[model samples]
Target: MTGWIESDRWAERARELRDEGWMLMDLCGLDRSGLGRSVVNAGGAGTAGAGFRNAEGTGGLYGPRFEVVVQLLHALKKERMTLHVNAAGDPPTVPSVVEVWPTANFLEREAFDMFGIQFEGHPHLTRILMPDDWEGHPLRKDYGVGKVPVEFISQPLMQIDSPGQSPETVAAERSVDELGQSGPPLRTVEEG
Candidate 1:
């Protein structure tokens, strides 16, 4: 096992890329000063294992500007890094780097789905995961995933699941009995 020091830990890995002109754009994260331990030293830029995977496990801090985002996407695509934009957490929006990095295309959308962060300047931005009618950004910091209220007093769980209908429909079909309770309850699961 090779334990490493902070200052030098990822310096070498980022050296070549940085040398090629990538600014150590905000060594940002919750771990580093203002960024908190949120970002992983900025080296996680455009790969499968990058950015702050919110400690709360609900959201994360993806630091990137429109220009940088586009650039990063382009580089990642050339290198074939699977890209996905994930900003469902609070302040749900990651900069549109697609202008600079063409690869950020679908990745940004995925980020939108997983994190709820909107990508401005994208040719077209729409729901890639949830349906367009999805009430809330499921991955957003403010997303509420609780099951809608129903009548344990009425149909009961066992009765709700009949025929080809999913349990959810049983509740929706009788939303009148479950008024004021359309979307599921929001859980304070993640905080940055």
Candidate 2:
């Protein structure tokens, strides 16, 4: 995609930019099949906040337009760059911008959390705020309301050995036969 866009005849010369480098950085959404249409950021990347979005689905500039991305790439030799995704959808996958800028760690993780975009080369990928058991990326454009189901099961209240006594330990003083027969269920004043 990067190479093709840079070679576009019409788009190459239109935007006045010396191609620094092309980045597969920014991600917009996640497609089950793979990455959907990418969010293309054009020239003036670091200097200014501008992107290339051909809205109306007609291959045209929508908002603040700058240099044709292709033109920018023509001037570069072989240096890393940044691709800034504009609108991320469900499960966005932005390539690691860390190679160019290691500072992208937090931002990329944030993008992963909110947009479900994964950075392929990210060293660590874990939920920052959400619990370990959380399901579904919460910040997607089409967030689903379904949640992970919870299951309840029975287990021993306490182990045989322990230093300090916990509620479970104190409760375990009584035998199972005595629980429903004559003794209190648990946590009764008598047990405490």
Index of the highest-TM-score prediction? 1
**lDDT (CA) per prediction:** 0.41, 0.42
Q: Kindly give the stretch of ten consecutive residues in candidate 2 with the minimal lDDT sum.
A: 63-72
Task: Tell me how many clashing residue pairs each candidate has.
Answer: 31, 7
What C-alpha lDDT does candidate 1 achieve relative to the native structure?
0.41
TM-score, each model? 0.36, 0.35
Superposing every Cα of model 1 onto the true structure, what RMSD results? 14.7
Residue 154 miss distance in model 2 (angstroms): 24
lDDT of 1 by residue, 14-83 (tens): 3444456443222111112244434332333343444455535534324332111212223433432211
Candidate 2 C-alpha error for residue 139, in Å: 1.2
Q: Where is model 1 more than 4 Å wrong at Cα?
A: 1-91, 141-144, 148-192
